[model samples]
Target: MSDRLVIENLQVSYGSGAQRVEAVAPMSLAVPAGQKLGIVGESGSGKSTLLKAVLGLIRPPGVVRADGIWLDGTDLRSLSRREFRARCGSEIAMIFQDPVNALNPAFSIRDQFRRSFRLHQPDLPRSRYTETMLRALASVSIDARDKLGRYPFEFSQGQLQRIMIALACSSPRLKVLLADEPTSSLDVTTQAQVLDLLHALQAELGFSLIIVTHNLPVVAELCDRALVMCRGEVVEDTDVISLFEQPTHDYTRHLLASMASLPRIASGAAS
Candidate 1:
């Protein structure tokens, strides 16, 4: 498969002087079409910052300097702000963590769905737009007629996550899904279910995925290739099975050991 996303010599930094910090090093990575790539590290390891740099969402004083970000050979960093935003929801969308915070509380599900639909299909008739919204909801196995009329609070976290996924997949312009700690908030069973859905969607939509998470089991189940990050640099890039079987980096081995030592959810929580 051809490369759908590419990054070379990517860097992100914050502040100056002795306090200066480099959040990401000269990192180079790529995601080909229909590929699932995992970036795993502990909290504050620059995983989120890396995704922000790609989206051009890094804030002031948090500088992101990169050599190239090519989407199907088109340099994304070269696009104007308007051009980038125009391409964002349509071309590359992100399913952020915390769907509750990410969504507007006041807007009903239907309204939000319609607004998102109109962003990409502005010329479609009202009836067609409604149809599209229902189709999108149904794609994620949501009951559009009943659920679309309800507020975000009416749904469970897992359901809201699926809604976010549906919204991201609504438009045909979406080529990639940037999943950041997507299943972190859910229980193991729910996490497994959502991950299954994510895998199915990737297969159905033929879109590439770049998932950032701390969950080793998630990485093992979801990703084909794994890139282990530590201290703002990629320490290991290998197949998931190989990395899990024999982690080379000291940090990678430590991470695997740490996850291995985590108590069972029920036992840990009961304590």
Candidate 2:
């Protein structure tokens, strides 16, 4: 099957010369048009670095190299920053773990929603933009009227996360969502609710997702395949069920064991 996103022999390093820290080493993976692939690892495992390299959001002083990162056969690394932004901003959207930090504190929910709308359809009339924003909020079960004028700080964490989801959904060309621990800061119940919302939206929108999280159970419940990262390399990649039933890598098994040893608190409890 053809991939919507492919990373080949990717390497990322932070710092210069002897002081440098290698974050990724010869990593490769692919996400087909509408598949959910989870990258699981503890902190410092390079999972987030991999995602940033794909997004071309790596800042100066950090070095990134890859044989190629192809998006539907186009080499993304070959494009100039402006060219890539023109294509990527609409075709790909990301949701961070903390929606509060991702959103603007001064802007109303309506203002943030407009940012997405402008990216996809800047020429849309005032009434049409408002209509699209309301529909996007409604799709996530948010009360469009009550929350539209409120700023990010005025809403609960779960509500803010859903609004971010709505912002992602507002863009018609969004074909992939790069989610980095989207529910890490939420309460257990809220986490499950947000995850379910993400699953529903992915299925409904026909968009692929690459979720980076250390939570094994969440990966089991949400993703079809898993990529296990240790240090700076991908040690294991397999279907989610197969991996849980019979893991190949020692590191993968260790991760599962760690998750198993956690308190048997129910989902949605503060972790």
Whole-model lDDT values for every prediction = 0.84, 0.84
TM-score of each model, paired residue for residue? 0.92, 0.93
Instruction: Give per-residue CA lDDT, model 2, range 1-271, as digits (tens).
Output: 5688988989999998799988998877888999999889879989888888898889978899999998877888899876687667577878888999999998988888777666655666778877888888888888677668889888899999998888876778777889999888888778878888888888889888999986887787778999999888889999999899999999988888888988532353222
For candidate 1, write residues 1-271 as lDDT tens digits.
7899999899999998897889999899888888888999988888999888888889978988888998888889998876776777777888888888877889989988888766655656787876788888888888778667789998899889998998888878678889998888888767777787888888889888899987777777778899988878999999999998989999999999999987433222111
Best by TM-score: 2
Tell me the RMSD of model 1 versus the true structure.
Answer: 3.6
Show the lowest summed lDDT stretch of 10 residues, model 1. Answer: 262-271
Clashes of 1: 1
For candidate 2, what is the lDDT? Answer: 0.84
C-alpha lDDT of candidate 1 relative to the true structure: 0.84
List candidate 1 segments past 4 Å from native.
Answer: 123-125, 263-271
